[model samples]
Target: MILSWRKKRAARRAAKKQNLEVTSNMELTIPSHFRCPISLELMKDPVTLSTGITYDRDSIEKWIEAGNSICPVTNQVLRSFEPVPNHTLRMMIQDWCVEKRSYGIERIPTPRIPISSYEVSEILSGIQTAKDQQDAERCREMVLKIKELAKDSERNKRCISANGTGGVLAAAFKTFSKVPFEQNVALLEEILSALITISPLDGEAKSYLGSDSSLHCMVWFLKNGNLSGRRNSVLALIEIVSSDQQKIDELLEIGGAIEALVKLMKEPISPSTTKASLLLMYHIVSNPPSSANSKVIARLTEMELVKILFEMLVDCEKSICEKALGVLDEVCSYDEGMEKAYGNALTVPVLVKKLLRISDLATQFSVSILWKLCKNDKSEGGDVLVEALQLGAFQKLLLLLQVGSTDGTKEKTTELMKLMNVYRDRAECTDSLDFKNLKRSY
Candidate 1:
C-alpha cells in the first residue's frame, strides 16, 4: 500500500508539472512598457509625440488623423506635430519580440540609421586627413560619400550644412583646387556640386565660402571647369556673394569673376544657372563699389554682356528677363554702358518691345535703360534720342506713362519722353504713337 501511494504521488507531481507548463505556455503576456497606451497591445513601432508621450506609430497617426489635437493620455496640446521615433524603446521591444519567437512573435528588422551631424563631421574629418596626406582617391571617395549623404534626405542635408560643412567644403576646395586641372578637375566639380546642393548657405557658412581663396577658386572653376562644374560654381558664387555687399565687392575685385560670370550668362548652360548668374550680376551692379564707374562698365561690356542682355530680353523667362534688364539698366547708367547699349543693334528695339509687355518690373527696368540712353547732357550724344524715336521708344514711353507704374518708373518715363520730343523730328520715324491719354501719376 505504501508503494502504491508513492506511485500515485509521483504520478500526481508529474501531471501537475505538465499542467503548469501548459498554463505558462497559454498565458503569453506582454510587458506593460512594451504596450502602446492607446491600443493596450504590444507596440510594433513606437514613436514619441512632442508632448513626451509614446505610442505606436500607426495608432498615434490614426488618432491624430481623426482630428485629435491633444494627447490621448495627458490631453495636453502638442508643442509640434512632428513625432520623434523612440529608438531605445523600439530596440527593447524588438529584442523582446525576438526572445518570444516561440510564441509566434517575429523580430522587428533593424531600422535604417538616419544621417546625423556626427556622421557628417566624421566623414569630413576623414576627408581633411586624406586631403592633407594628398590621398586623392580617398579624398574623392569621402567627398562623393558626403554628397550621397547630403542628397539622401533633407534632414541629412540640413544636419550636414548646420554643422560647419561649409568650412569643410571650403577647405577641401582650397586643397583640391591646387591639384592640376587635368588631375582633379572631376573631383573639384564634385565638390562644387556638393556645395550647391546645400544652398542658401547660412551667414556663417557664407562667410566661410566668401573667403578670398574660395572666391578665386570658384572663379577658376567658372573659367576652367566643365559645363556642370561651371553652373555649380556660379550657384555657389551666388550664395557667397548674396551674403552681403562686402562679399559682393570682394568677389568683384577678383580678376576673372565678372568675365566668367558674363560668359556663364551668355552660354546656354541651363536656365537656373543663367538666372543665378544674372542675379549675381544684378547684386554687384546695384550694390556699392558703384556701377557707374567706367572701368566696371568696361568690364561688363568688353565681355558682350550687353548683347546677352538684349538676347535674354526677347527669349529668356520672365524672371531672367527682368534681371537682365535690371543689370542693363545699371550698366547703362554709366557713359561707357550707354555707348555699349547704343552700339548693340538689338538693344534699343528689344528695350522698346519689353516696355509694357512683360511685367511692371520689366517695364521699370526698360524705361530706366531708355532713360539712361537718352539722358540729355549727361549722355555721350543725342544720337540715341534719334535712334530711340526711330525704334518707337516714344510710343512705349507714352504707354508706360499712361499705364500703372511705380513713381520712380513714371519719373524716368516722363523724362525720357521729354528728351525724345526734343529730337523727334530728326529721326526718320518721328511720328509718335498716340499720346492723347498719357498721364503721369507722379
Candidate 2:
C-alpha cells in the first residue's frame, strides 16, 4: 500500500511540471508572433480568431490600412481583421509625399525629336555642301533633296532658333538662282506651274522663293515672253509678290506686267484674288517706270485705273476695302503730274466715303491719302477739301487727332493736324458755309 501511494505522488508532480512548461512556451511564442515587423512592438488591442489565434487590433488595422494586409515577417495575410485605421494611413501617405518632394524629382513630358550629336553633325555637313557648290543647276537639284531631308531637322531646330525659316529659304534661293539663265527659267516656270496646280502647297513653298528672288523671277518672265504670252504668267506671278513697298516698286518696272495685272483685277474673281491683282496694279501705277512718266501716266489715266481703284475701295469685303485704301495711299504719293491725271477721276469724294465706312486702320490710311492730295496745293483739291469739311470730315479728323495724341500716333496725329489746318485755310473764302465755321471751330 505504501509503494503504491509513493508512485502515484511522483506521477502527479511530473504531470504538473510538463503542464507548466507548455504554458510558458505558449505565452512567449504567441506574443512574439503577433508583434508588428515595422513597429517592432508588442501587439496591442488583442483580437481572437476562429482558428484560436490572437492578434493586436492596432497592428492588424495598420497592416490593412497600409494596402499591405500581409504580415511582413510571416507573409500571412491579415484580411479578416476589423476596419483599418484610415486617419493613420492618410498621415503615412502625406509623409511619403513630403519625402518625395524633398528629392527635387519632377516628371517632365518628353520631346518629339531627341536630336543627338551624330545627327546634328550630318545635317551641318549637308548644309555646308549645298551652300559651297557653284553650279546653279546641280545645286538646285541638291537643294530640293536637302530640303526634304532637313524638314524634320528644321522643325526641331526652329524650337531653339529664330532665323531657321530664313536660313532654309536662303539656302534654297541661292541654289535656284545659280543655275544657267535658260535652266533657271525652266525651273521658275516649273515652280510656278507647281504652285498653280497645288494651290494648297503655295503657303508652304512661299518661303522657298524669297521676296527678292520672286520679284526677279517675275521680271525675268515678263521681259523674256511676248506681251500675250506673258499676260497669264505675270498674272499668276503677281499673287506671290510681297506687299513690301520696295519689292512692289521693283516689280512695277517690268514692261507690260502692270497692265496685265490691272486687266486681271477688272475681271470677275474671288475677292482675295481680285484684291491681290488690284494691289499689284496700284503699286505699278503709283511707282511708274523710271522713264517717260508723262506717257505712262497718260496711258494709266486713259485706262481709267483710278475709277477701278475707287470702286474697289468701296467694296463690301473688308479685306478688299483695306487693300484698295493701301493702293490709294501709294498712288497719291506720285508727283504733281500724276495727281493732275488722277484729278479728273473724282477721288476725294470716294475717299471721304471710305472714312465713315471702314475700320480704324482703313480710316487712317484713307485720311493719309487725302492729306497727300491736299499737300500738292492744287486748286481742284482745294474745292474737294471744302466739300470734305462740309461733309463733317474735319470733325472726324479732329477727333482722330485727339485720340491719336493720347495713343502716341505721332506721325498720323501730326498729319491729321496739318490736314485740319490746310482745310481751314483753304476753305476760308469758299462758298461752303460749314468750312468757314470749321475754320473758326478748331
Global fold similarity of model 2 (TM-score): 0.43
lDDT of all the models against the reference? 0.77, 0.52
Taking the tens digit of each residue's C-alpha lDDT, what string does model 1 give over 214-311?
67777888888778878888788778766566776677787877888888877768888888888888888776545335677787788877877786
Worst 10 residues of 1 by lDDT: 433-442
Candidate 2 structure quality by residue, lDDT tens digits, 48-142: 33333444444554555568755554666555534332333333434443444423322222223323345545554554565465444554454
CA error at residue 285 for candidate 1, angstroms: 3.2
Q: Count the backbone clashes (under 3 Å) in each candidate.
A: 0, 2
In model 2, the number of clashes is: 2
Candidate 2: residue pairs that collide: 136-178, 136-179
Off by over 4 Å in 1: 1-47, 50-113, 131-134, 179-182, 244-255, 287-292, 377-399, 421-442
Give TM-scores for every candidate, taking all chains together and pairing residue i with residue i: 0.68, 0.43
lDDT of 1: 0.77
